[model samples]
Target: MEAKGDGSAEADKADFQKMIQGMLEKAKQLKPEELVFRYKGVLYPSVPSSVQTLQALGNFQARPEDLVISSYPKCGFNWVNLLLRDIAFINQNESEDGKPGVRSQLKLLEFENAGNYEEMKNDPSPRIYGMHGHYNNLPSSIHQKKTKILVVFRNPKDNAVSYYHFCQNNPLLPTFSSWDEFFRNYMTGEVCWGSYFDHALVWEKHFDDENVKIVTYEELKENLAKGVQSIAEFFGLSLSEEQIQKIAGRGTFQAMSDNAEKTHSSFGKVIFRKGVVGDWKTLFTKEQSEEMDAKFEACLAGTKIGAMLKYDLYCKE
Candidate 1:
């Protein structure tokens, strides 16, 4: 939002102030250990105030047309965003500004902007919102209204590594001096937005729910056309093969990187680091890799999600 030349400088700054104000209020109430909360035996990177906020969110009012895109930090949230926008705008006339989504239409649950929330609350139907909240922390309205929810998850190995670099670059989060420190914090769920395992597994329980849909980052990356088609189908959007191809083309890493304004805005450039699968291999040492594997095995031994997510800490190629 500092503008640095993305063109939306003034507006970005205002929204950033709101986000910072929200985070500071939560930060003010944090105890040394309360920087993260342990709920249901899983650690979450939320302070006491946010925990209260999460409880309050249980009463949040949601509309039937609202769609919540949920995921842990750095776990393909942006990719899903781009894909969703492309799906929605594929055959339609492009915006006059040539942006992805209507700037005023976007909403975020994790980093709430008071201005944006007011706008979103009064906005038209079929509003799309993004959040990194765990399933238990989501609004009760989500279940009550049966508002369509899409959970996009990535392999934890890649997720952790991606998050480590993200912390180093993003001003909002604490920067780590080394990958070792970052990995230790991540394994213990000390980073912002909480544990990837908890976020994914909690949402996994709702995979069978009629209003919920889950997609893996690996599957999306492996065959984006198929991924786009599956997402379109889930969202009940109709598109032909040509349209699907167009969406996939524009949603690619290179294309999105080239058009950051349309893809990611307000500190989003830093969010667009290496968009690849299995980059964790370069970052993780043998011992760390084995440790993560053990943790994953122990945490997800009998859960279907272990396989559903294709959980392999050490992936070659």
Candidate 2:
């Protein structure tokens, strides 16, 4: 029996090595010659393992009660994620100190830790996972089970501006020489994670699906109380005004950043840069703003999602 167990262990080791080799090959295929990697139209950081994570997600199983906080990169994922956690355990008043809120409570499908896959597979009910993948690329089981998907979108213009700074600040990505170069790539969906509009549109297609709710970052920014209420409602959680206030207050960019010691994973300040609404004004030129406006109108026209968001790019004066 011991010999049989040894043989099984060896087989498992071999399988793991084979999986690593496969990931290496996938990395080569997906890694871009430019700043970041792009695989099947999805932009990933320069990290080869992230590419593998995305590939692995193709086969991930999802339960019906699972809550997935998904967005194209830089679309308030961390913010929404924390809000969900607060709502989930508001009464518990769980402090995320050594407890590590997000890592301990939530699952990230594209998490760098491969062990998370097995851990999540074994985790208990009502699993909540976060991801930064295009809507179409979501795990087949999520669609099959009609898992509850909470998607967040920022105005494409704001998203672009935020993304520019993120790519610049994130050491994992290749930094651009100028905002102009980044803008060009972003407009064309050539940057990591591809076009903002494309990502939004894909999720927009599923707006009518019972299991999906698409919320705008602008909406969250506009009224955190209302945002929290809506999120709670979607998850069938009834929140008192007080509970709503707690969740909203805790989930704010300022609050998250201030408590980075407890809130952030290893990457602290990088995750919480300039989480404001109209900061785009400082960055975009008049011509660039006009161009972005025209593009937003052209691409988002006649879509319910576009109508819902009103497609405005400027931070309101």
Best by lDDT: 2
Cα displacement (angstroms), candidate 2, residue 150, comes to 0.5
TM-score of each: 0.80, 0.82
Off by over 4 Å in 2: 1-35, 48-50, 91-106, 112-115, 313-317
What lDDT tens digits, residue by residue, belong to model 1 across residues 1-317? 11112346456555554654565476666564555565545444553224544454555678886767888888888778767866766535555554444332235564443333445577555566777787777777787888888888788889889888886765444567799999998988767666777776787687688888888788887889999998888877788897788778778876766666443444457767788888998899999988888888877767766776777533533
Q: The CA-based lDDT of model 2 is what?
A: 0.71
Report the Cα lDDT for residue 213, model 1: 84
What are the C-alpha RMSDs, in order, of all predicted structures? 4.8, 7.7
- Over 20-125, each residue of candidate 2 has an lDDT whose tens digit, in order, gives 3544455455433543566776666654345677777777878887778888888898778877877876634445451213321324576544555656778666
Error of 1 at 143 (Å): 0.8
